[model samples]
Target chain A: MAPRSIFLLSSSRVHGYEFLEHAKEHLKEFLSKRKVKTVLFIPYAQSDYNKYTELVENTLKPWGYKVEGIHAKSNPIQAVLQAEALFVGGGNTFVLLKALYDANLIPIIRERVLQKGIPYIGSSAGTNVATLSIHTTNDMPVTFPPSFEALRLVPFNINPHYLDPDATTCHKGETRDERINEFIEYHKKQVLGLREGTALLVEGDIATLIGDRNAKLFLPNKEQAEFAPNSDMSFLLNKT
Target chain B: MAPRSIFLLSSSRVHGYEFLEHAKEHLKEFLSKRKVKTVLFIPYAQSDYNKYTELVENTLKPWGYKVEGIHAKSNPIQAVLQAEALFVGGGNTFVLLKALYDANLIPIIRERVLQKGIPYIGSSAGTNVATLSIHTTNDMPVTFPPSFEALRLVPFNINPHYLDPDATTCHKGETRDERINEFIEYHKKQVLGLREGTALLVEGDIATLIGDRNAKLFLPNKEQAEFAPNSDMSFLLNKT
Candidate 1:
């Protein structure tokens, strides 16, 4: 069976946290109705010795839910297989990628999340892993791992930490928009440019943007426009 | 002592070829007085082996200069150390990066080109390597190599193949400009947005644009503007 759904958060900025709160609400509702236990997985949490896991535990424990922290090695394939609801937190995308490759857990995690219907929630690095490839990650290539292949959970790419151009620094180098446009021009694939507080909630064949404001939609040879959150499923469906 | 000047081509596109021609002119002028020999390094020239090299060799041979093809493995350090004038052709940035890291050649190449002043030329992957990092490379992450550290010959990033928005596809993604803007916003670094048919020719502290038209310059928090080739030495000075 497919997991309940997949939630991709592009960043961990303040707005990203708010989106997490919204996701928590939905998860709580789903768990209450299903009468089942839920588990949140934070792979990068191990680096900080349960700092992230404790935060999630504290937030969800009051809702009568069971939260456990799986601090396995960089690759936690076994732990991922056993989790019901997996929530990956935000951190360095390159580090997360290295861990996934070192453990050879990319394929396992993808199968569990996509095929086993493991409701997965990812932010930052987690969100990057959900894409067809992690080529669009903004993190510097400080260290290269074995393979750049991502989870390929979605066909499009993800550009987290999407921000508007600062006119003052616009002349310093290639604007963020220009760099992403180069990718769009070359690949002609759909890429979700999620602002700090926005997310794409995908269930089955359905994807809805959940957040406070409209996210920017960029298409090849077209003028960029802002679309309200949860505006339409057309864009998501067309790409998928 | 630094070798004579070199030209870096951004791609093999028609525009890229035109830029190469323009670069050839400058290289010829620089060599005329000093009798400097020129070599074209086609790292991506895997199968079609003789086509690009022959073309470049034939073109420059008539000018009383010896033109040779480099067929070494992807060890960028070796390639840089052995050559006087280097011309890097564009193909796949990821592949080029993989080769550079596999041979552990990044640091040595950086030293030879940036510090020792080997006349360096790069286009496409070559140009991408000239930047602080390859985070803006448009290639997919099919495989991860050992390191993502680029030559960092320049302080800013490079966004080659910069194109305007297109509307024909149903794909929704971030624009090229937007992507670089995002990086600038996060890192406060400058990025050179080089359109097709544009090349950056650096000689000592002088980095000048060469080609048909002016290239776009993007800086964090500043308005993007077009500057004529060799318009100002201030930007290039800061980078060196």
Candidate 2:
């Protein structure tokens, strides 16, 4: 099996950046070394597949990259097998997972990405499905998937668009930090809270925290470690 | 069915109020006309049943109401069968639904409330499950339940702790309004956004929107209607 190559972005867009303008350079550098130029886009996370596919295609086409929508293809699994790179856009995590299950492409997508080492790019809900399960996503469960389990491509779960608690906010619902704490009470897997403008670059058993902010790490029975951006987070690769 | 006696409070607690304090007067009036003196409290939504039950017991015990924890009972179904009133506290909706399934109490609880007409009180997560399905809940799906389908006590789904878009806030993820809009894209139910301090008083075929503030209503195709606090929203009770 080839080494894992993946980019799990906290979100596709950040403050002061056009849709994916902020991650333009990072995305280019991540896939620059790869041989494939044509990318297969999975627009299943949203209800409007045509609009979602067009938005992603427009963003990457300018970079001399060709993007294709998987929904428009006749054979999805075969498309994944032949694709050079895979990009899963963000909308709703439950919607994305259900579409993946409905298409019966979970196994082959896992094979092409993990076994064949095709570069995988995910943002927000897209970034969420890269983990062991979809337990940590912040999106509403508008739909139910067959199981909470995901591709298991990564060792732990990822909480994308992880925002810090704003003490001034009057909303009484659980804050992001408290929600993750509650999740750990029921789940044992370590979770990395990726703040906006951050991405986890995974390559060959090594995962590095990239971007301008520090990421918070939550492990069972331990204090949350603040790992600064551009820090070596490959230790997370160690399956406890 | 004894005229559908149910009150779905948006939250158990409101700002500047003690736990369940804001809803105390409403609770007293809802169950006052009935003869049942003992109320059964299901603290399954939260982890600490002992503390949860005690807190609820203290609040209602002043009015000569006896509150007992269902978790402490030997046979939960029989306990529900004999209970005068049913109170479901708010915490996490997924946790509440999963525990309901685990205890094998869904059917019995359904019979007692729907068939026998026991006074049913629910707040937050509790209130979310009183609807047809839990698809509109704002709480995280920390645990999986037998199904998203609930008691079907109410014809439409309920979005508890439903806050309006904060014009001052800059958080970019989908707002509460956007989330419900997305839900309507896939689901065909009307979702009423119950702000804190608000509730849907479901009695027979009438659901009156009661509170100091106006609640936002979302239908499939029509513009969102703004209903006043005392507005008779019983029309929602009509199965669309």
Candidate 3:
């Protein structure tokens, strides 16, 4: 298998940051390393494709990268084939996966990232699809995709924008940790709880946690462990 | 169609309350008004059906209700048909709906509630299944049911344990309001956000909001509204 370059971002914007501003340096380094010129943006997660694409374009323009929306292209699959890199923006995971399935782009996108070694950038919902499935996503199922199956760029599932339980909260909804625990209770797969502002950058078989906050990992029948920023997470990529 | 008798509880346990403690009065009145003797318990949302049933049985025993686990019966369908009243306990909505689907009980249960006029009580996940679909649930997609389609006992969807945004948080994940807004964006259905310790009680054609807190209602193309406790919510039932 060819070495793959993937950036799974927890969120596009952290609190008090402009759109994609928190991820500026990392995005620049990843795209520069791949020598990417123009990036194809999957904005199907949002209702307004052009508007979403514009947001990404505006944010990345200063970084010396050109951005285009796949929705605008007459032939999306062909666009993927010719693209230097891919950027899937953050929004509802259900809507994003359903659009990907509707356009018949799942397999092609998977091939581009896994086989062709095109650098793939995913924020929130995008990060979700890059995983094995979107089973652990925090988004509501506003829409139904044909399947929860995703790109499988990574072996394990991811819970992006992972929030810890507020000690003072009185809300009775299951805590983020509890929800992940329930997910593992039935599906015997590891789930990485990617805290907000964190990103998992995988180059070939080596994966590294890329933020200040600790990333929590959950496996069935095992106590969850947390990884600090810059810790090597290559073991996750090696699983199955 | 006969008027459905239903209690859509936001949660089984509220903060500082024991299991079913916050809902004891509402549960007692609903079952008592219907003259229910033995309550059929569906504990599929949980891995341990027996343990879940016991918890409910213990909670309702003092209220003069005999709680029986549907899982214990030789014929689960027969159990629903013969149940004086039905109680669906809180847990994972995905697991609960899938088990109901696996047993082919969705139609039978709906018929029992809508046609037979038997009282149906739902807590959290249970409340989610009693509505048109489980799309608005706060629970993770821990497991995928065959479809997001759920029992159409009500015209709209209910988001049980609906939470308000934490103004102090730094997390960029979509808040509960944003999630419901996303659901309405695609589905065009009204979603009632049932806060913990709140419930919607329907008897015949009228539904009333119960508890001290107000319930939030999300409708497509309109500003979300909140209904104070004891408000007449029968308008929600007449939508379809």
Candidate 4:
């Protein structure tokens, strides 16, 4: 089987940058390495697929790649099968997963990315579905999917745009750490809390954290540990 | 049938107050009117039901009410049927809902509160389950229940401990308003964002906001609205 190449980003826009400005360099380099020219974009996370697709197209066009949304294609599965690369943008996780299930594209997309080794780029909600399940998502359950299970491309779950608790704030809501702890109490899987401006790049058995921020890792029955930028996180890729 | 009496609080502990201290007087008044001497506390939300029940018991001990945890009872449904009042505390909504379904308590609890008119009190996770569904909760989906369909005690959804967007923060996570909008976009139901320290008291057909702060209301296509302390919120009770 071919090795998987996946770029799971915490968010599209970061502090003091335009849309995807922070990750542009890394994204360009990743695509360039594979000589990927045409990209199939999944815009099902947003309510307006046309608008979302147009935004992605504009962004990728300037990077010297042609982008086409799966929504406009007559057959979404065929689009995935024929694509040079796949890009799934961020929005609502539940909406994105439901749409993938509705289109019956999860297995095909998984095959293309896992078996064929097609490059995959995902941000926020897209990053969420690349994991084992959407159980760690911060988004509201706007819509119900048939199940919380996702692509399972990764052994662990990803909590994208993970926020640190404000010690001074009087808010009584559960902190991000508390929520993650609650999740681990129920599910035995490890969860990686990817702060904004960070991305995890996986090449076969190797996984690395990229960007200027640190990522938090939560393992069941263990204290949360932090990983700095460019830290090797391949241990996360090991089977649970 | 007795008139329904319910207090749906945003949080158990508010700023500069001990656990349930700020809500003490109001809770006392609500229970006093109903002449409720005992409360069957549902502590399934928290992992340690015995400890959770102890906390509630200590808090309500001075308020002149006996508290018993449903978990300790051999028959949870029988305890609910015989209780003079019910109090569901805050923790994880998904956990609490799944436990309710697992123990087959939803139907009996609904019949007791809606038809028999037992005084019901809920805080945070508890408040989320009292509504039509748990879709608007801010908690993580650590576990999956049979369905997101809740007790349907009220027509509208409750978003407890609702927070406003930080004006100067660069975080890209969806704001509370944006999440609520996404939910309404799909569910066609009204959502009341209960700010910290506030609550809704329902006495039969009348519902009133009680506390120092204002609560925000989101209707599908209408401009978001706010309600001040003591403001009438009976419109939310009207069926969608």
Instruction: Give per-residue CA lDDT, model 4, range B1-240, as digits (tens).
Output: 878888999999898898999888899999999999999999999999999999999999987889999999999999999999999999999999999999999999999999999999999999999999999999998888989989888888999999998888889898888899889878777899999899999999999999999999987784689889999999888886
Choose the strongest candidate by DockQ: 3
- When summed lDDT is taken over every stretch of 10 residues in candidate 4 chain A, the lowest stretch is A216-225
lDDT of 1 by residue, A54-163 (tens): 77777777878777776743436667877777777765566677777777777887888778877777887788878877776765443455666688777677777667
Angstrom error of the Cα, residue B51, model 2: value is 1.2
Docking class of 1: incorrect
Error of 2 at B129 (Å): 0.6
Write one digit per residue (lDDT tens) for candidate 3, span B32-120: 87789999999999889999999999989998999999999999999998999999988999899999999999999999999989899
DockQ, all models: 0.11, 0.64, 0.86, 0.85
lDDT of 2 by residue, A1-240 (tens): 899899999998888789988788889988888866888999999999999999999999998899999989999988888899999989999999988988888888888889989999999988888888898988888998998888878889888988889898767777887788778878766889998889999998889998889999988753588999889999888888
Off by over 4 Å in 2: none
Q: Model 4: residues >4 Å from true position, as ranges? A: none
> Chain A TM-score per candidate?
0.84, 0.98, 0.98, 0.98
Worst 10 residues of 3 chain B by lDDT: B217-226
Task: Write the residue-wise lDDT of candidate 1 on B19-85 in tens digits.
Answer: 3464567667756644467664655522344676776676678777776666543644566677666
Give the runs in model 3 whose Cα sits over 4 Å from its true position.
Answer: none
Q: List clashing residue pairs in candidate 2.
A: B207-B234
Could you tell me every candidate's TM-score relative to the true structure?
Answer: 0.58, 0.98, 0.98, 0.99
TM-score of chain A, cand. 3? 0.98
